[model samples]
Target chain A: AQTVTQSQPEMSVQEAETVTLSCTYDTSESNYYLFWYKQPPSRQMILVIRQEAYKQQNATENRFSVNFQKAAKSFSLKISDSQLGDTAMYFCAFPSGGSNYKLTFGKGTLLTVNP
Target chain B: DAGITQSPRYKITETGRQVTLMCHQTWSHSYMFWYRQDLGHGLRLIYYSAAADITDKGEVPDGYVVSRSKTENFPLTLESATRSQTSVYFCASSEAQMNTEAFFGQGTRLTVV
Candidate 1:
């Protein structure tokens, strides 16, 4: 079984400030994919970033990046120049390699961006 | 219209009653999944379908029923809705292969009284 864990329950960051959300997972599979999802007040799940297990270089999408340490089984999301809209619940998820593509998600961290 | 959609964004029902949630996707993705999100539990998979008529139980499959009659539609049913079953339901779809990105729907907020 694969499980994802987000240690931080809540975090507050000033507008335009940087914030990092921590995530860790337990999986025996060597090949998999990690993802970060954002759910705002509207309750829509939005993809923030994704990292492939084989890729040594972290994934970056504009101001969103990841610090992926495969050895330690850690994947953290870093949001730079964060805005008020970034305030939401962030979830770390992974899909173990297989045919079903089942996704396991973390409990999530409630992020609040204060202006 | 072009993306995945779940019907009755918000629904309220009584306990022990049977309720069904509808999900449809236009992407024709080979993989479709149903997940439940609660306050403490972020998101847990309930059921998933690899293709039309090929469904499998997920982590929390108890007290739930699912059917995939067509490639575009996958409906989930609760034979006897309980207060514990009250949570947000999400429908997602992805292309071939588990490594591909999965697209999530807006989610259905179901409340069992």
Candidate 2:
């Protein structure tokens, strides 16, 4: 079974500052995909960024980036220049192995950007 | 308008009653999934379908039923609703490939009293 864990339940960051959300997973698969999703007050789930396990280089999408450590099974998200709009619940997810491709997610980290 | 959608954004039902949540996608993706979001549980997969008639149980599928008669629709049903089942439900779809990203709907907030 694959399980994702987000150790931080809640986090806060100041405007223009940077914040990093920690995430770890237990997976035996050698190659896979990891994703971060943001859910705001509108109840819409938005994709933040993604990282492939086989690639050693980190994935960066504008201000959103991921530090994926395959050997340790650690995938953490870093948000640079945090803005008020970045305040939301962030989830880390990965598809399970097999044909179903079911996504297993972490508990999520509630992030608040204070002005 | 060419994305996934979930009907009855908010629903209230009595215990032991049956309620079905509808999901539809226009992309004709090969995989559809149902997930429940709770305060400390993020999103737990209840059911998922690989194709029109290929459905499988997920981590938490005890009191839920799902059907995928069509390629674009996957509906989740609760035969006997309970207060414990009150949570935000999300519907998502993805391509057949393993590394593709999953597109999510706005989610349905279901309350069982």
Candidate 3:
């Protein structure tokens, strides 16, 4: 079984500041993919970023980026120049059996960007 | 209209009553999944379908039933709703290709009282 862990239950960052949300996982499969999802007040699940297991270079989407450490089994999301709209619940997800057929997620980190 | 949609965005039902949640996707993705989100549990998979008529149970499938008679529709049913079953349900779809990201619906908030 694959399990994702987000140690930080809650995090806060000032407007225009940077925040990093840590995530770790345990999976037997060597080849897989990891994802970061954001859920705002509206309850919409939005994809923040995605990182492939084989890629040494991190994944970047606008102000959101992931520091994926395969050997360490760590995938952390970094949000730069944070804005008030970034306040939401962020989750780190993993695909079970190395496929999207069975996706698993972490408990999530409640991020608050205070102005 | 071009993305995945879950009907009855909010539903309230009595215990022991049967309730069904509808999910439809326009992207024709080969993989579809149903998950429940709760505090401290994040998102737990309830069921998933690889394709039309090919359904499988997920991590938390005890009191739920799902059917994928058509490629575009997968409906989840609760035979006897329980208070513990109350949570936000999400429907997602992804392409058959490996390493593809799954797209999600707005979610359905089901309350069993």
Candidate 4:
């Protein structure tokens, strides 16, 4: 079974500063998909960004971007100019990728953006 | 109003009791999923449905039951609740196409005592 791992359980950054959350996965397939999801303290979850393994270029969404290293099996999320609203639990996910497109998520990293 | 939603945002039940979690999506997506979120285990899949009358078990489907007679409704049931089954449950839906984006609903925090 494939698994996603987020090493940092908690992280923090000052408002307007930048922060990076680390994630890794174990997969043998050359082409796949990876994703970053944010769950606000209010409990509403949203998709931050997604990356396709087949693409060499990384994916970026506004102030959010991903550092995807296909070889190292690492996919890290970088938040630039973080806002107080950015304080939430971020999760990394991967698709099962065969017949079932089920998503397997990692233990989230709690992020706090100080004002 | 046109998105996925889960009922009983918070639930408390006793062991050996049967409880059901309701998930409804307005999108009528072809795929719907039920996942349980735990402290260290992340979100483990409990069950999924490809369409009405098409359901499949996921990684953690042992104590849970699911049915999808309608494309817009997918309900998860716990035949016999246990303390270990207490966790935040999330319901998500996506299009039939692979690699498409999946949207999640506000989770249901279930507590079994």
Tens-place lDDT per residue, model 2, B28-94, is 9999999999998889999999999999999899999999999999999999999999999999999
RMSD of each: 1.0, 0.9, 1.3, 1.3
lDDT string for model 1 (B2-96, tens) is 99999989999999999999999998988899999998888999999989989999999999999998999999999999999999999998876
Each candidate's iRMS in angstroms?
A: 1.4, 1.2, 1.5, 1.5
How well does each candidate superpose onto the true structure, as a TM-score? 0.97, 0.98, 0.96, 0.95
What is candidate 3's lDDT per residue for A62-93, written digit by digit as tens?
Answer: 99999999999999999999999999999999
TM-scores of chain B, in order: 0.96, 0.98, 0.97, 0.97
Between prediction 2 and prediction 3, the one with superior TM-score is 2
For candidate 2, give the docking quality class from DockQ. Answer: medium
Q: Chain A TM-score, candidate 4?
A: 0.97
Q: Give me the displacement of residue A88 in model 4, in angstroms.
A: 0.5
How many angstroms is residue B44 displaced in model 3 relative to the true structure, after the best TM-score fit?
0.4
Query: Model 3 RMSD to the real structure?
Result: 1.3
As a whole number from 0 to 100, the lDDT of residue B32 in candidate 4 is: 96
What does the lDDT read for residue A45 in candidate 4? Answer: 79
lDDT at B16 for candidate 4?
Answer: 97
**Model 4 ranges off by over 4 Å:** none
What TM-scores does chain A show, candidate by candidate in order? 0.97, 0.98, 0.96, 0.97
* Model 1: residue B43 alpha-carbon error in angstroms: 0.3
Q: After superposition, how far is residue A73 of candidate 1 from its true place, in Å?
A: 0.4
Ranking by DockQ: 2, 1, 3, 4
